[model samples]
Target: MVEFDLVAPRSADEAFAALRAAAPDGAAVLAGGTDLLPDVDEGRQRPRVVVSLRHLPWRTLDWAGPSLTIGSTLPLRALEQDPDLVRRFPGLAEAIRDVGSVALRHRATLGGNVVRAAPTSDLVPVLLALDAEVEIVGPRGTRRLPVDRFVRASRRVDLGPEELVRAVWFPEARPSAYRWQRVRPANDISQVAVAAACSPADRRWRIAVGGVAPRPVRIPSAAEALGAGAPTAAAVARAARAAADAVAFPTDRRASADYRRHLVATLVERVVDAVVRAEGFPR
Candidate 1:
């Protein structure tokens, strides 16, 4: 059996110190442990130490006017239950519901998902469409990066060894929708997911796709095809096709490249249409 030391720091400074001390030997950050625990049990990861963020004061959700901030350690279930969260960011709410079962979501966290940087993550695509930013705190101090820049690829992030994700920030609320195709709806991973949103401030649309290799990315060309608010059917089709052709889908055990391409196109169209209707755009 593999054995390792576990530490729960009471403060951010202590957390960083613990991480720094354990870095040479290898250390893994434990948030919700929804993913980390699985990796550890499956022998996919073997660290000398595991640093838990349980004692940190990061479980929070705050809204300032139109902007919102989600504390890193906050449980996904808590976020999903907030009525304002559902009303203000429906796509995000939909993605959160797709994460795992209720019991799993009770322990799963948004920060953990972002840090995991899984290409199949349901939340990241919505975050991309919402133009979210990640806040990080490290030995060098705190800094923020756009979600697009923060998530580099599958199981990879731009976080430093001694850094902790503090929170995720959204610039403003948006009318959005998220849709995905999966083997099972309850606790299975997505084969392909699409997130669509329109900025109330600018009336410009944002589109992003998940389940692609490397990472989930915002498709600027797809958004361009959408043009401004309440795109006509032709524009929506163009955007969907653009999204379908933009990404290089991976042929893995779960799905084929062609199947994913088709899913992306279909889901993109559905999500965009949903967002438009949700916003009460004229038919």
Candidate 2:
């Protein structure tokens, strides 16, 4: 690993100042360091300075009115095991559970996962399906963006160089399901992943897909079809096919473009089926 200076700020103010004063050579924020550390060790990243956010105080999960607010530095394992959180957002819980392994989850933060902006991130699609929003703080101030829009592309996000992700807020809980396909059964990045959520109050279905595009994508067409009327197996299949066709998967070492497309359709079908059944809607 390249030699670098580490700055640990005890508070958000200190962290902000450190970010503003970051050297011209460049600086990278460190949350759990589950991803950043690996890149540094692999020589893929060699920032002159690393700002560690682990010392910041925002590491608790709470309910703010009707919405669920998750601290940016909270461990993924915390969310995966929280009974209340699991009951409120089963899809999100499942996604977090599938991220890496028990040991990794203990060190991985939701904010880091979102900010890393990996196309294969397990939580991105599920958060998009839930219409989650992220709170960002920078030299300017705080601003919010939908989870779907936060990630611009692979390893890219909307955050500025001096910005820090504060927390993620979910409007409310809804019936949802998440599924992913991987090359192996052990802890591995997903080749294709799909998440589906149904808002019975509005009779709307939301769908998001990952690992088949440059970034996670929401499938409005598929959501429309499955939510148009009473969901049926035939309708779900048609919608899944449409979604599969919509994504242009790039050929990667883990899977071919054609195989990724196939996985998209199959996973979408499974997610829709699971969501519909869980919502007590006939199919």
Candidate 3:
């Protein structure tokens, strides 16, 4: 392991200062360290300093009417266990459960996932489907960006040197579902994943997929194919087809490009159908 200084800031201001101070040499912000530590161990990252957010007061989950704000440091298990999360954002809840195992979920955090911006992240596709926004705090001030804009590419994000993710904001509750095809049933990465949601306010559908290169993304064509409200079986099939053709799937050790394309098509239909049925939409 590379030698690095570790600092746990008690306040947001101090955290910012610690980051700014360590900027010249390279610094890493640690939430739960589930991702960061592994990267460090593998020599993927060698920061001069590791700023820990453990002492910060950011482990929060709040609901205001239809909106939800999740503190960046909050554990994935906390989200999975939230009584209303499964009902209001079923897709998000399902993604949380899919992260790893119960033990890993206890330490894995939403902010870390977003910050790492892994191409195969199970949460990102659902966040895209939900139109989630990332709340960032830095030396300048706090700012927010849509998750779509926040995540730029694989293992990359739009975070500034001194910035840290404060929370993720979901503007409204939606009827949604998440599904994935993995090599193993438990503690394995997904070969392909799909998240589908129907906005309650606009009655429009949204579809997002993972396991693509660069980043997870919303498939507008697929979503449009679903039309408004409950989609017919034919429409769902069309959407699935559209999704299957949407992204350029990469052939990796886990699966072939053709297999991923097939999985996306199949999972898209299942997720959309799940949202429609589970949410009691008129079929």
Query: Which 10-residue window in model 1 sums to the lowest lDDT?
Result: 274-283
Residue 41 CA displacement from its true place in model 1, Å? 1.0
Model 2 TM-score on a 0 to 1 scale = 0.95
Measured on C-alpha atoms, candidate 2 has an lDDT of 0.86
TM-score of each: 0.97, 0.95, 0.98
Error of 1 at 50 (Å): 0.8
Q: List lDDT for all candidates, in order.
A: 0.92, 0.86, 0.92
Candidate 3 collision pairs:
none
Clashing pairs in 2: none
C-alpha RMSD by candidate, in order: 1.4, 1.8, 1.1
Candidate 1 TM-score over all chains jointly: 0.97
What tens digits encode model 2's per-residue C-alpha lDDT throughout 67-181?
Answer: 7999999999989889888776888988998988999999999999999988788899999999999999876889999988898988889988788999999997777889988
Task: Give the per-residue lDDT of model 1 (tens digit) for 198-241.
Answer: 99888899999999998898999999998888898899899989
lDDT of 2 at 76: 94
> Which of candidates 1 and 2 reaches a greater TM-score?
1
